[model samples]
Target: MNNKQQIEKMTDMMSKFIALVSYKLPDDVENKLKELSDEETNPLAKTIYNTMEENQNLAQELKRPSCQDTGVLQFFIKCGQNFPLIGQLEKILRDSVYQSTLDTPLRHNSVETFDEYNTGKNIGKGTPSIFWEIEEESDKVEIYTYMAGGGCSLPGAATVLMPGEGYETVVKFVLDRMTSYGINACPPLLVGVGVGTSVETAALNSKLALMRSVESKSENENAAKMEKLLEDGINAIGLGPQGLKGAKSVMGVNVVNTARHPSTIGVAVNTGCWSHRRGKITFDSDLNYEINTHKGVKL
Candidate 1:
């Protein structure tokens, strides 16, 4: 196919994929929520879980988005240096998002900074934010599309602690943030924590951590253990579905850590609500594609 054809094809695929992701939670996430609901002992929590399940079912059956806030589109791209469509990638993605907004009936979430006017097309200066990571060894491009809604974004917090504070402070910081703000984030959330040398790095890492599978664990032994500990502690708080007081506060807590400066330990926390609207797709140099997050996904 020619460059124009490639752009059109990719744009079509992305628009369809965005619509699919808006309405469906991945199979693993769905299963996790089911397990949590079955294991929960609180009546109120159980009712909330049922409501969430119903919401998903209705969204799928009616071919509608699961939530009203479709969220600003964000793409995390890992593009191979030699990919055929490399030159046209960014423009194609921008066009895809803009087209998808109208084609999928996506909510108009992008607004101009000072004018404060809705673009209505979901495309504007720095909108449909794209983060690029170039790789040398592969011939395929992989992309992660995430929808961070208002509720989930509300509880995001970050801080730079004195190095003297140590890892214990990291743990405390996450817990404190969850306790103070997580309730507003629409519970049964996936908590992402980033620990690094500065606030910006920490914030970026925290967002990246959310892209990891809900069932996955950190590679570092210490981090893995801390993940489990936080998971248990948070669940014990009984935040239950939508924070109505239940047996589980989170789907998981993923901590991504890196070496930090001796003087400062920065931490950032972000959450994905039960809807957790995100999807992953990989495309070969030939434009053949795979959608891994949803089962029997045709697009």
Candidate 2:
């Protein structure tokens, strides 16, 4: 195929992939939910988990979205410097979002700010946000597609803390948010915590954390320990399934940290609700593709 045809084909593939992710939970998330359901003792929590499983099955079987709020699409891209389609990547992704809106019939979630008008197509000024990271000496591109649903994204927060406050403050911040507003996002959340020198950087890191597998751990020993501690502390809250109170408040806790300014500690929180619609796909120079987050599925 010529370059034009290649771009069209890739865009179509991505559109289908987006639709696929909207309906199907990633493998890791599905497994985690199953484990939680089996381990849950509360009758209400058990019923809720069972219903969630039913929802997943029906969505797939009927070829429909799992949730009514199809969410705002976000793409986190890691592109290799030598990838053949590097030049066309941005346009391809934008086109894919537009096509997915029509093909998947995604909920009209994007609205024009200040103007107070819905875009209807899920595409508007700066809608369908894309973030990029260029990798060195590689020939493959990895893209993380996430659906940031309204309720879950509402709890996102970031702030700069006094250096003296320390990591303890970070823990307190997350706990406060979870206790106060987490239920609005739905319970058994996968909490992503980001620590950096500034609020924006930390916020981005927190969102990135949500894309990680629920079973994954940070490389840094301290961060890994914090993850475990936070997970334990949150689960102690007993928010359970649908926040009706149960054995666990969260599915997992993930921490992503970076070197911070000596005077400030920036921390942020992002939560992914139980449905957690996200997927990872990679493409080589030849445009050969692999789906890492979902298995036994074709785009």
Candidate 3:
């Protein structure tokens, strides 16, 4: 496709894809919820899981968002340097969010930081936040679309610790936060932990961690071990489904880490409630596309 045609196709495709994300949980998430519900022994938690299933059914049937918040849009893009629309990708995504907001009828959750006013179209400053990665040798682009609801990603916390405080402190910090606020995030949660050199790096890492599949494990053996330990620790809290109590408190815990300054250790936590509205899609130079997170989706 030519440059102009590529841009228009991309914008239209993404608007529909993101709108689909509002109502549908990705395949991995849906499967994880089913697994947790099936294994859950608590009657109340089981019932809550059933209700969540019913809610998904109704959302699909009615063609509306499953959760009321719908969340502010966030896009993580990995684009080829040679992609025809690379320069225009940002505008295309911004326009996509605007179009999706109208077509999906998303809730107006964006407010200016200091001005403190809702942007009715979900198009306020920095709304539909985009983070980019450029590939040098190809012409394909991959995008991950996420909805950060107030109860989930918005209220998350982060901190930096002294080197003397140790990695153990990171464990303690995450556990303490989950114990104190995880329930409020509307469990069972997809917990994302970021460990890096500073609070900002850690914070962004935590978000990128959430973009991975619940079943994924870190390639770093130590990090993978930490993921298991954290997962077990969080689940042992018994916050369960909707925090009503059950066998599992989270779908899974994902840890994304980076080299840190010797004197400092940074950690941040972000959560995705059971109805995590995240989706992944890829497009080739020709604008032919595929949805990676949701199976058999035409868009």
lDDT, candidates in the order shown: 0.89, 0.93, 0.92
lDDT of 1: 0.89
Question: Per-residue lDDT tens digits of candidate 3, residues 1-299?
Answer: 67777788889999999878998899999999999999998999999999999999999888899999988899999999988888998899988888888998888888999999888878888778999999999899999999999889644789999999988999999998999899888899999999999999999999999999999999999999999999999999999898999999999999999999999999999999999999999998888899999999886
Better of 1 and 2 by lDDT: 2
Candidate 1's residue-wise lDDT over 40-88, tens digit each?
Answer: 8888888889999999999998878899999988899999999888888
Provide TM-scores for the models: 0.97, 0.98, 0.97
- Candidate 3 residues lying further than 4 Å off, grouped into runs, are none
Query: What lDDT tens digits, residue by residue, belong to model 2 across residues 1-299?
Result: 88888898899999999999999999999999999999999999999999999999999998789999989999999999998889999889888988999988789999999999998888888878999999999989999999999999988999999999999999999999998889988878999999999999899999999999999999999999999999999999899988998899888999998889999999999999998999999999878899999997898
Q: Is candidate 1 or candidate 3 better by TM-score?
A: 3
Ranking by lDDT: 2, 3, 1
How far out, in Å, is residue 175 in model 3? 0.6
Tally clashing residue pairs in candidate 1.
0
N/CA/C clash count, model 3:
0
Winner by lDDT: 2
Candidate 2's C-alpha runs over 4 A off are none
